[model samples]
Target chain A: MNKGLLIVLSGPSGVGKGTVCSVLRSKMPNLTYSVSATTRPPRQGEVDGVNYFFKTREQFQEMIARDALLEHAEYVDNYYGTPRDFVDRTLASGKDIILEIEVQGALKVKEKFPQGVFIFLMPPSLDELKQRITGRGTEEQHVIDHRMSVAAEEISLIRYYDYAVVNDEIDAACKRIESIIIAEHCRKDRFMSELADMLPASEKV
Target chain B: MNKGLLIVLSGPSGVGKGTVCSVLRSKMPNLTYSVSATTRPPRQGEVDGVNYFFKTREQFQEMIARDALLEHAEYVDNYYGTPRDFVDRTLASGKDIILEIEVQGALKVKEKFPQGVFIFLMPPSLDELKQRITGRGTEEQHVIDHRMSVAAEEISLIRYYDYAVVNDEIDAACKRIESIIIAEHCRKDRFMSELADMLPASEKV
Candidate 1:
């Protein structure tokens, strides 16, 4: 059986990356969303392994020391990371894995696994992103400003990604992301290796 | 407006490339199928521009001399070539362009236009290709053998292509090609420039 592809997605905070991932997961059943292990306490209605793999700070540091995490980050006094084992197992079982990470983590993963497909999501515009952030009404003005500043740094790194999808419209962005996945699977290297075993000796010429 | 992409398609004979192209065209309305200029006589029901841009030997040679064609070939006492003007105009107008050419011509286009997306369509397996070739019932046994040999040589060059779609099922192959085209449009370079313009200054922080 052909192994599944590893996809790494990164973007600014309010680029609708989560929505794209959710829509894609709904459309594709064989996709496995890589859950990160976090050292932070679970929020209301959150479950272990479902929402996140809640790990102690010591455990998180241990995983980092052992190089067991594909990528990890410490944000807002909480440590979070993607477990390498789960992703590897999912891919080994022919299930595509998606890692929604930040630019730093994505760059690290790219360095470790050069073959992984990296996708960067972009908001329709900075103005639109500000609107979305303000519309959410969840963050204070100062926090929104901080996010906006961070977005500029992230946008500058867009050139490093293998592909980019602009989240101007949810459905269109989701479809475009899905198409990218399909196109990557149709890559020549992947197809030739898969076709090798299917060719008959007589037909090999 | 940003321009659409130019995709160059090539495959071994009897690989169901024509059928796949036809199906893909039906599904993608914005796709412009490039018409080649040829010195060959038009068959019954063939129209100029639609079937081919039939040209006199002198005209075809003049085009070759002027470098008017993207790629050209001489076969069966006739000259055939893809006109560059129409393809360029179509892509510039934000419509995708498709060029159905042989492997040699495909490589030439790739060398000339490095940004052109190259796709190679292959049969699911050599045995399956033989079955399809025999299924056509128009070729002699010797001709089939000749095609099989050529196919082997063509398969060896698959490494050069950006993508490959196995023509196991006509609809599936077409969908895959269509998806690749759509996905290519969402490339980060194209989106970043456009998105940068739409961003508001306030949101840049």
Candidate 2:
């Protein structure tokens, strides 16, 4: 049996990664979503292990020290990370797992798991990306300008990805990502060894 | 615009490559079929350039000497080969072409166009393969055994292929091949350069 694919989806902030991920999860019920460990209080209806693996600052630091986390980062006052064990277990059981993360964290994960499929999501255009960021109106003009520059930086790192999907529409983006996962499974590298099993030893030349 | 894909489908004899390819062509109206140049005399109703580029023995030999043929081989008393110019023109015009050929010819084409998508069709099992060969009933028992051994040899070459799909059912096999093609277009190598075109110079970093 083949191990499941570890699909990591990343892009610049506000590129609709969250919306796409949610829709993908709903569509592929069999796909497992990697739960993240966070040092933040769970909001209402957010179960400790379900929404986030609630951990104290000490516990989170311990995980980082032991290298139990695949990738971790501090945002505001909280530390968030991907646990390595869950990913390993789900894949070994032949179930695919997906992680929707920011670009920096995605690169860090790639360093650890080079075999994982990396997908970089992009907005229809940078102009649209700017509008998406601006529509929120939460950030000041200078801050928005800073984000645009950072978005360009993330796009520059597109070389490291296995597929770049334009998030022109949420449903269309989800469909493309799903196709990438199915296609990755059919990749020659994955099936080369499997083919050996199909041919009996006595018949091989 | 993206260039058309060079889809080469090959497999052991009696693996139903022909049936699957015909079905695929009907479904994909835009796909172009590669026409071969042959030294054999054209039969009734066979049109020049449509059915084949029928050539005299000397003309076929000249095509081989001039390196105009992509791959050529002699069978019985006739020679057949693919034309390189037609393939280049079709791809340059942004249209996909499919070549349904034997395993040996497929390997030769792969040497010249390593980037082309190579799909190796297979039977459900060797036992099934033997049955498919035996059912032909056109050959003697000794010939059937020879073909079975040859099929085994070809199955061992799956490592060179981009995908191996079992022809358990014609429709199922076609669907898998179609999925492979769709997935291939999304490959990072193909899209990496296209993404650069999407961003204007000023937006690039």
Candidate 3:
């Protein structure tokens, strides 16, 4: 079986990446959402190995030292990371896996998994981004302003991404992501090996 | 308006590129087939501008000398070429254009239009290719052998293409092409400028 694609979706904090990813999961049943490992305590209703692989500080640090995490970043004094072996096994099983991550973590992941389809989920407009952040109404004005600035910086790094989908509408964004997956499968570099077998031995290049 | 894509489809003669392209045109109404200029006499029911921009020998020679053809080739004592102005005008007008050409002509077109999406259509297998060509029953043994050798050589050149589509079924090939187009639109380089406008002036890169 052909190895499945590793789709990495990332964007600024308040760009609706989560909502788009959640909707995309239901549409693509074959897709497996990668469960991240974190040192942060699980919230109520969050399950270990399902929502996250909750780890102690020492365990997280050991994983980092052992180079077992694909990428790791500290947030609010808590460590979060992807397990390198989990992603490898999923892909080796020919199951498509998706990682919805922060822009920094996505870039970090790319360092090791350069083959992953790195997609930047872009906001429709700055005004829209600001409104989305404000609409959350969970944070103070200072927190919102900080996020907006971080979003702006993260968006400027889109040049490093393979594809950019404007999150103007969640469904539309999901559809475009689906098309990208289909198109990536058609890319010559990825599909060339299959065609190589078709070429007659004498004519093979 | 975003500049439309220049899609170039080519394959061995018996690989069903024409049939797939025709079906694709019906599905994608905005896609315009680039009408070629030819020195071959208009066949019965063939229109001048719609079917081909029919040209005389002297006119074809003048066009070649003037570099007015995007790509040209001589076949069966007849000259067939793509008009540079026509393709450029159509693309400038923001209409996606498709070109169905031979492998050699497609490569020539790429030398000038490297931005074009080059797709190499493939037969499912050598047996399938032989059957398709033999089914026509219009050639002698020598002609059939010559065509098969040529097809084998053309298949090897797939390394130069951006996508290698197996024309195992016409509709499947068309759908893959549609996905490629959608994915191309999402490519970071093509869509980045649009995102630039959304960035705050201070954050523009």
Candidate 4:
């Protein structure tokens, strides 16, 4: 079986990455979503390995020491990270996995897995990003302003990505990402064996 | 408007490259099929600049001297090559162009345009290739054998390509090629200015 691809998706806040991912999951049922490991306690109805690989701080630190995480960060006195083993096993089993991370973490993951297809999601415009943040209606004006500024910074990092998908319409964005995944599968590097098989068996290519 | 991609499609003999190109043209009306310049006299009904850019031996040699052809070779006392001017103008006008060439010529074009998406069309299997070649009913056994050996040699050069698409079914192969073109547009290299635009004007990214 062919090995699966590791897709790293990152975007500025309020760029609709989550919504696009949800639609993508519905479209492709076999796609594996990376569940992060965190030291924070799970809320109600969350399950271990399903919601996250909930770990103790000591355990999380041990994992960090062992270099078992693709990327990790400390937020609110708790540790959260992507475990490397699950990703490796899923890909080896021919199941594509997506990692939805922040820009810094995504860049860090790229340093470790340069083969991963890094994609940056973009809002239709800066105005749209502000509207989406305002549409949430939960954050204060100051918080919204802060988010817009941070989003601008994140957009600057898009050059580091392999592709930038504009999420103007949910279906169209999903289709573009889907096409990217299919195209990556057709990459020449992935078909070396198939090419070799086409050679004469006696030639010993 | 976004600049168009230069797509180079190559395959071994009897791999259905011509058939796929025909179907692809119908599906993608905006795509431009590159016209080649040749020193050979045109056959009856072949139109200049439509079928091929018919030129005299002196004219073709002059074009070569001026570095006007993307790639050229003398075949059976007739010069055949892809003209660079038409391709450049079409791409500059935001129209994607497809060049259907042999393996050696495809590699030669790669040297001139490294950004071009090089795709290798492949038969589902060697058995399928033989069946297709024999189905033509025009070539003799020795000719078919020679074609198969040449195909094996061409397949060995697939590593030089950017992508390999299996032509199991014409429609599916065309769809894969279409997806590849769409995905290439999303490449970061092609969207640098768009990425810069996504930043806030005050940010000076």
Candidate 5:
């Protein structure tokens, strides 16, 4: 089996990326979601390796020193990062992995794993995104307005991504992501070795 | 409408490219097949621009001199080439065009239109390819042997293609090609304009 693709998916908060990923996981059983390493203590019912690899602050610092983290950031006094070893192991086993990150984190991963497929999930429109955010009924108008501005900044980074998948409908978005992964496998660079094996020894024409 | 993709599909003879394309055309009604202009007179029932754009030798040479042909070659004393204007017009109309050509011709098109998606169709195996060629009952053993050697040479050029689609099954091959085209549409370069338009104007956070 060929090595799995490292896919980095990023979008604004209200773009429905989480829902699309959940649907995609259901559709693609072989897909592995990369569990992050974090300094924060896990909540109840969260399993190690399944949810996040629980790491102490000291251990997380050591991982950074060793270049073991693909990309990491400190959020609310807690360290959160993707473990390079785990991602390499999972990909070497021929299972595709998806990393859901914010725009800055996604760009960081791009620097380390340039071959990884970077996808930007977009909402159908700004109006739709506003509605989705408003439908949550948890944030104040000021917060919603701040989010819209941040989303615009993130959308501007779409040029850095290899693909832009609009999360207009859950099923369609999942299907398109699946198709992108499948099509990526057909790339000539990935299949070169197999093609070489199929070629016969030189013979007179 | 989104701009159309220029797709160049090439494979060795007897790889069932024609059959796959026929099935693909039936499945994808929006796809346009590029008809070539040739100095050779059309056979009975062949209509201009439908079967082939029949052109006099002088007319064909004039087109070449005017740089109106995307790619051209002299074969068996007849000049055959793809018209640049036709392809540009079809793509401008937002209809994807498929150019089914030999490996050499496909590579020529690539030089002119680097943006075109190049796909190399392959058989399941060399043995299968030979079997298919012999099944036609139109060539001697020597000719079949020569064709097989040439196929090997052609397969070596797969590195130049964006994707290598194995035609083990026609339906599967068509689906894979369709997926590639769809995925190509999501490419950041193609969606940049739409994304910029989607970005909201300055608003207070």
Candidate 6:
């Protein structure tokens, strides 16, 4: 079996990353969505290992210190991290692993695993994004403005990603993500070891 | 409209490239198969510009002299080449173009158009390839052996390609090629220009 790929997807809050990922996970069978470990208390009906691997703040720090986490970030006094073991196991089992992380965490993973495919999702337009954020009717006008500002900053980092999919339409975005995954598997470097086994005896010399 | 992609595909003979290309062309409506210009005399029922852009030896040599060809090669006292104009026109019209050439010519195009996507198709195994070559029943046993020997040399150059698709199954191979085309379009460099245009006016300053 071929080894699985590690894909890191990052985008700003209102870019529709979740919608695209949800569709892609349904379409692709061998994908494993990495469940993050968090120190935040579960609100309700959240199960450990399913919703998150709930850990104490001290335990999370210990894991970080021991390098057990692939990547971790502190947000609003809560510790959230990707445990390394599950990711490694999934890859070893020939299942593609997806890490839906922020830009900072995604950059760290890119540094650690240079071969990992990094994808940044973008909204079609700033006005459209503002409309979507405001259309949610959950955030204040000022909060929406702040989100838009942060999105602008994130868009500038698009050059650092391997691919960028614009969420103009959910189906189109999902198809693009699926295509990127398929193409990455066809990469020459990924097939070299398999090809070596198929080389003719004379050519093996 | 966004400009189309120039994809250069090359592999050894009997690697099922034709089958893959045929399937991919059927699946992708915007794809244009590049017709080559050749000095070889047209066979019965062959149509100029459809089968090949039939050219005189003098005209072919003139094209080489003027650098009108993207890539060209001499074989059996006849030259085969890809004209740059038609390809450029097709791309300008926002249609993807495919060049089905040999490894030598493919690499030459790479040198000229560094941005063109290069893919190498390979057979499942050497024995499988030899079987496919012999199974055709058109070539003599000695000719089949010669072809197999040449295939070895071509396989050695597979590392130079950006992607490789194993021709174990035709449908899967076609999907892989199609995915590569879609994924290449999502590459960061391609999206950065569009992203820059979409940035908010305030941020642009």
TM-score of each: 0.92, 0.93, 0.94, 0.91, 0.91, 0.95
TM-score for candidate 2: 0.93
TM-score of chain B of each: 0.91, 0.96, 0.96, 0.95, 0.95, 0.92
In candidate 3, stretches whose alpha carbon ends up further than 4 angstroms from where it belongs are none
User: In candidate 5, which residue ranges exceed 4 Å CA deviation?
Assistant: A200-205, B40-45, B200-205
Question: Which pairs, if any, clash in model 4?
Answer: none
Error of 6 at A112 (Å): 2.4
Better of 3 and 4 by TM-score: 3
Better of 2 and 6 by DockQ: 6
Least accurate stretch of 10 residues (summed lDDT) in model 3 chain A? A191-200
Q: Give me the runs in candidate 4 sitting further than 4 Å from their true place.
A: A201-205, B39-46, B200-205
* lDDT measured at residue A150 in model 2 versus the true structure, 0 to 100: 88
Models ranked on DockQ: 3, 6, 4, 2, 1, 5
- Summarize candidate 5's per-residue lDDT along A119-202 as a digit string, tens digits: 999999999999999999999999999988888888888878999998888898887888888889889889877776688656
> Model 5, chain A: how large is the TM-score?
0.95
Q: DockQ, per-model, please?
A: 0.49, 0.52, 0.76, 0.57, 0.44, 0.63
Which ten residues in a row are the worst by lDDT in model 3 chain B?
B196-205
lDDT of each: 0.85, 0.88, 0.90, 0.92, 0.90, 0.88
Model 3 complex DockQ against the native: 0.76
lDDT tens per residue, model 4, B62-156: 99999999999999999999999999999999999999999999999999999899999998988899999999999999999999888888887
Q: Candidate 1: where is the Cα deviation over 4 Å?
A: A43-45, A138-140, A195-205, B190-192, B195-205
Q: State fnat for each of the candidate structures.
A: 0.63, 0.52, 0.83, 0.70, 0.61, 0.76
Encode model 3's per-residue lDDT on A36-133: one tens digit a residue: 99999999999999999999999999999999998999989999999988899999998889999999899999999899999999888888989988
Clashes of each: 2, 0, 0, 0, 0, 0
TM-score, cand. 6: 0.95
Which candidate model has the greater TM-score, 3 or 5? 3
